[model samples]
Target chain A: MAKKETPEVNAGSTADIAFLLLIFFLVSTTMSTDTGLSRMLPPIVPQTDDAPPVKERNVFTVLLNYKNQLLVEGEWCEVSDLREKAKEFIENPLDKPNLPEKSDVEVEFFGTYPVSKGVISLQNDRGSQYQAYLQVQNELQAAYNELRNDLAKRKFNKEFKECSDAEQDAIKKIYPQRISEAEPKNIKK
Target chain B: MAKFRKGNKGGQQKINTSSLPDIVFMLLFFFMVSTSMKEVTLLVKIKSPEATELTKLEKKSLVSYIYIGEPLSSKKYGKEPRIQLNDAFATVDDIESYIMAERESMKEADRPKMTVSIKADADTQMGTITDVKQALRKAQALKISYSARKANK
Candidate 1:
């Protein structure tokens, strides 16, 4: 019997097949880079019989309702104004009698509580929109960052990010971020 | 002139296609390097809110995503927002175990550096978010990031 010759497969079309697959991925895939607001969740505290009550003066309360209305310290406030309000409350530059109390502990380089010992307490209703909640949170954080930056600038003649580790630590000690987010309350519609 | 004309007629000219495959392969490699496959199929529809104060999550391996939004197939899941962990819809109760599992899967040194990124829809309520946050707190996943788009000026 005569030897049979195997038919040769075509290699010229392989590039076309790869090109099709490449185009499919190029069109369908989204190269999304994730950006976010970084925060640290407070550690869960064990329920004790007697936890000391936080002083009313030490608590800077912010309430957000379902209507996206903001009630800051029992007064209506706009989102745009929250940052300045929070900064004022935290810094208390005027040393108002009703504002947060100054700390007793004093360090050499940093004074005793140029920033207040008060905690910014955020309370939101269950029906409140997440957008509103985040906006408020953003404002609160901005207030802290701005204050810290200002302090860093005054102390070290540098921005917060540009300060040395010890200088940054001192600034943070003076102006610590103390935001307390309360559990969402049920509001009657 | 007659010999030259006869030679040109005897041989048909063809454009060189040897570099075509190389060019195509180069493009393929470029796409392959830039393309990252979708990690988990989204069971919920999420449109993250926009904000000016945004920080990019630098390490992909150090971050785990928790998605919160209404189910895409609303007919089956209803309109209420739900929490999604990885590829499945999870209730608040599932967060502890899910976080523990994720932590266990990582190297011991990397465990402490892990961050939970919550990607929630703009319209979702704060109640769901608070519950998730409580769950994360109990799970000891302290570091958290709320995913949002960069606001346009």
Candidate 2:
């Protein structure tokens, strides 16, 4: 009768090889942050102790609930309204500019006197969550862009909306400041 | 010739087993050496959905990502999860305001140039994620990406 043959494993050497390989991976691999989106950040506010505080109205607040519903100034509104509201508030002060009598206007923040604060307070119901907040944000940006474009057009021609596209572009390039800092009506409470 | 043939007839070839061990070890070593290290999550087990065609984001700036999870509970629904822009949680609902703030504070060199990345739970509703994306778009945030992991692994 033939003897049965048994397979042998080089246990110690195998263990050593595995250990070395594991160590190599540990040392060589780099961890990465799961990232999303690249945005051109707005310029920083000038850092000066003497600079005045931004008025409450100047800061807009848009709130969202857990259900993904949006609330602007505590009143429920569609996400679309954010842009228009932001544009309006940013473009026109809640008060003034309509008075027939010309009077000395002391600008506390910018434009005519500030009144009735317009703030967007976003209150998320633990349920409505992150994505909902993002939706609200997009609407706001669209509003800003529209307002900016409108302002730029107005600056170059004063009658800009009626001017040729090429002419408007020429004017815009010539007077960048007018287009850049057409400071929207200061948001006032 | 007959004697030589007779002697060879009873002889058997011996197979070498040592090479088998070496090959196994080499393969193990190769995989170990080539395997990459993944992110160390906070010990939270989340089962994300799978996609066949995966695109890796080597650069971080291309996406605006937000993570949605139960703030501190096991309940699947009813509970409101915490919200944050990347890592910073804001108390207000004004997402545009926040983006504007971030944009305004950013340097001229870092002008708003980014893609949005959303890393929400698979179990999370699509509406929430959409809303967040919309917000980014409203801020004129053009590029965006979603964060996903290997479905099988």
Candidate 3:
């Protein structure tokens, strides 16, 4: 018999292996979640012996329950109520009789005074729902915007929207204690 | 004799790679057995902020993961921001001390600068998030980042 040459075999098996490995990783890898906001926060100022304590009552308390329910001033209120409440209280500064009779409170000359009514503390109960939490935030922001607009209109005695940026900023900070409180929180027990 | 010599020359030509399948399969098999993929550690949950641009970080730095959420308390203490950094739980105080200590131990050559990759829960309080940011600044580590999933449209 005539000698026969060795036959070649299919080598596509390697390509198949690569394809499988690629597919495996693509399916097996776990995706990461998004971490919110990159804020350039201010330094924490160490308290000095002369430094006055932050006013406790000046804080506005908004509490959230585990059910995501909201309570403003210990009253169960809808998420939409926050903005209106903020606007009503912030703009019409209460006659804070307990506050120092000084014309203005300076940062350098810190003093203890009854917390201004404009300070709002928004608290969420631990059980409060997520959607409710977001709803409350949106309303609070809206309230601040409304307060700003109202202040600008009073300053210009005209349509608030037409007010200059500088004029708006000036009026917004005109009442420094207005809306000076921090954001709402979910306080754990 | 001339025709026979011509046939001999034609038979001497070399074969191309296309004609070889067995050798290619053997190489593929070798690589499959030897190649190993790197394993990545499981990071905490976070809802990254929206950004128009994304950039990768340097490999040499020490990464600290801080989680934003309640400290598993049940009594309801009114509204105060709560946070947990690594194993210790506190309001955001230990953040500065921890980063400072980590910085001190780093080797001169391997000392990577500090940057925090916050992995926060989607339902975490904004106050807690902001508090953590403020703490990082107090720690004097401004090179902070939020871990995010690559967007797939």
Candidate 4:
């Protein structure tokens, strides 16, 4: 009897097989470059009977109603102007008497309590749109960033990102972000 | 001159494709290494809002996502926006346990670095988001990120 011969397997189609698998993965997978607004939530504190009330003048009230309208200090304000408005409120460039203040700590650039006691009180209605809320928050943050950038440019002759850690910390101390978000209020239809 | 003369052959020469598989395999391996598999199939529709100030989340291992939006199949799961933890639709109450479980699963050293990312639709209301925020604060997950796209210039 003749010895049985094993058939030679064809390997010519290996590349084609790999190409098919590669195409499948390429179509199914998405390369998402995730970007976001980083924020740290205030630690939950137990309600105490003796908590002192924040001064009305120290707080820059920003209210968002159900219709996506903005009310800055009880006056209707446009979203486009929010950044400038917030900057004025925080920096109090003219040393306005009504603006927030802490103990005088003279700094190299801006004077003491530039924004230490200035709190942006943000309150939104339950029916307020998320987009509007986020935009408001963005503008508030932009105000702080712009203030810091300006200070960095003045003191170090460089942009905020180029400043050293200590320099950045100094700038931050002069204009720290003090956004306080209040609980959403119920809106009656 | 010698190198130029070497390419002067008139006869038809078929290009070699024997190494094509090697090049393709290299690309396949590259994609496999760089690409992370989609861990959860999205049931809700999320069109994140656009913003100017955006920061990129650096480490994949240290981040967990919390999705909030209306269900794609609105007929089945009402028109209201809902919170989704992983693949399942969840409520604000589920956040505490979910965060605790996620923290427990991580290495002791990495627990402090964990960040919770909220991917909510632009049209979603503030009420739901506020609830999520409160839950996160209560859970001691202080570091939070609101996922958003970069606005076009």
* Clashes by residue pair, model 1: none
Per-prediction DockQ comes to 0.63, 0.12, 0.11, 0.67
The TM-score values for the models, in the order shown, are 0.82, 0.33, 0.40, 0.88
Q: Estimate, for each residue in A39-153, the C-alpha lDDT of model 4 and write its tens digit.
A: 8888989889998988877899999999999999989999999999898888786777777665466665555533457899999998899999899988988898998899889
lDDT of 1 by residue, B43-124 (tens): 9999989888788898788889999999999999999999999999999999999999999998999999999999999999
Which parts of model 2 are misplaced by more than 4 Å? Answer: A1-54, A93-123, A156-189, B1-118, B121-153
Task: Write candidate 1's Cα lDDT for A80-127 as tens digits.
Answer: 999999999998887888888887656547766444788999999988
lDDT of 4 by residue, B10-117 (tens): 878878787877888888887887888899999899999999988899888889899999999999999999999988999999999999999998999999999999
lDDT scores in order: 0.88, 0.49, 0.53, 0.88
Per-residue lDDT of B17-128 in model 3, one digit per residue for the tens? 4534455455545555444333333223335433222335444236566665443442553333355554545566777787787678676664446667666555665556
In candidate 2, position B100 carries an lDDT of 70
TM-score of chain A of each: 0.79, 0.42, 0.52, 0.81
Error of 1 at A145 (Å): 2.5
RMSD of each: 4.6, 15.4, 12.8, 4.8
Least well predicted 10-residue stretch by lDDT in candidate 4 chain B: B1-10
In model 4, which runs have C-alpha deviations exceeding 4 angstroms?
A1-12, A102-115, A187-189, B1-10
- The residue pairs that clash in candidate 4, if any, are none
Q: Which candidate gets the maximum TM-score versus the true structure?
A: 4
